[model samples]
Target: MKPRRKSVPVRVGNVVIGGAAEIVVQSMTKADTRDVKATLNEIARLKDANCRIVRVAVPTREAAVAMVEIKKASPLPIIADIHYDAPLALMALEAGVDGLRLNPGNIKDPEKVKEITRRAKEREVPIRIGVNAGSLPGRPKEGAGVRPPTEEVVAAMVNAALGHIHILESLDFNLIKVSMKASDPPTMIAANRAIADQISYPLHLGVTEAGPPRTGAVKSAVGIGVLLEEGIGDTIRVSLAGDSVDEVEVAYGIVNALAEKLTGPNLIACPMCGRLEIDMLPMVAEVEKALKKIKRPINVSVMGCVVNGPGEGQHADIGIAGGKKEDEQKLAS
Candidate 1:
């Protein structure tokens, strides 16, 4: 493997991001953060699924107040997502959360921002300066509107990020991470690249408000996948609007794909062209269903005709292929 680029590792609890550590996977809890029991249950599920860090919305006072119990029960470290109100930031920190997410586009007050930074320093908690092109402010009326050019969008996000950065730096609080997100693939990719060039902070990567399972995965995988390959993101989140567990699953899949070793099951099947052999479809289907329930990273393959199937599936740890007489043969290579 090639060497990692110039980057400092940021510690989220015991897990490390960047600097020779295995990429860390994080997911946000959708349960109302105020509902501690529900939130804890969700967090526990994510933890069992190997989630390294968990983020939760601190939208209201009840949610912010519940951070203490959530933090106590969480198997992984907690990040409080404080949007507009800076007071929630203090509440989360006081509750002993491991980190804070302060969105510059949403946090409008300077004094409240300063106090949040100061208190974060006192509490020794890390802050994530999150930005999304969707939430970018002050775009001119007649221009591209929500879809500003990647460079323009990056500048806006970086400026707001730096503003919050300066406050934290002034108070000598250095545990900072930044993210610049957009719904469109190209915009999301370019904004993150531009921001990485400007700041040395670890980056959190994602495409916000990505739609359903199929399209959302493709968008996130393309945008974020490109960045990770270029050695960009430090921490990543797959912001699927649906099941939070799916988000965790997708994030890990991307990481696994990035790794040199193919850990999980690898599906290799022929398109069932003219050379197809006896009952290849059912054979391949059986292999897939068998491996679907696997939790550990294990590799398997399925193919159609014996001619191409065996050779192609040879790269896999365990594989199955169609054979004569309505039967199939399995291979290990």
Candidate 2:
């Protein structure tokens, strides 16, 4: 991994983002924010999945008000995601949320933005200028003109984020983070790279609307993993269509695969080929199930044949290699 981009640290409740902190994993609650019981239940599940921070939608006054109760019950820091309505942002801040995500493209009034920034600054709450490609302010009419170049998309996203960053900076508020996301992986990666070069604020990474669990995980892993490996991302969220807990799991998987963060056991298994002398699939499955219960970070391998099996297996802390027969199984420690 390359050296991480230097960024000013921002604190969201107890979790610190950027500035030497390990890249943070965040996920959103899928339940209606107005339903405090449902939201809190999802928050608990995300926490158990090792989500470092959680964001909940604040679309209405009722949802904003409910944040007070939800924040009190949530184990992870609660960031209220507000869009279009500036009053909801105020209400969320008044509700004592740990952080706020304000989409400048939707809430365009500078005065309203300043008001929210002032309140968040007073409360020492960091605000994220979340710019989504689907919601770019003053976007060109689709049918009225020729299609714009792809670079325009990246430029527009970065400019939108900087515009919001300017709003907070003009208020003398420096506690900030930024995210410029698009469903397209290349666009998301390019926009973040542009913003990382222009600003020192922490960046929250994601591939917005990245589809179902399988495809979303792959998209997020590529988008976030590439930026993280380049040392550009400070935190990340894997946007999946299923349970939000799966998003947290996928986020950790990306970070783990990059070897940036190690939270659990690392499993290594060889693909079965004609050289295999044993049924490797079931054995590997059983080993994986048992390893998941162990929290200690260790490398465990299950190899099928002797050619590369013994060599790779012996390198792991605990390993099993197959021989000519089932009784000839070799264990390495």
lDDT of 2 by residue, 1-333 (tens): 788999999999999999999899999999999899999999988877778999999999989889999988889899999989999989988888999998867998989999999999899999999999889966654555544455888888888888888989998999999998988788899889888989999999999999999999999999999999999989999999999988987887787788744666778888888888888899989987786556566778788878777787777777788878772345565
Q: Which stretches of candidate 2 lie over 4 Å from their true place?
A: 140-148, 276-279, 327-332
All models, RMSD in angstroms:
2.6, 2.6
Model 2 deviation from native, Cα RMSD in Å: 2.6
The true-structure Cα RMSD of candidate 1 reads 2.6
Give all candidates' CA lDDT scores: 0.79, 0.87
Model 1, runs deviating above 4 Å: 1-3, 140-146, 263-296, 326-331
Residue 170 lDDT (model 2): 98
lDDT of 1: 0.79
Model 1 clash pairs are none
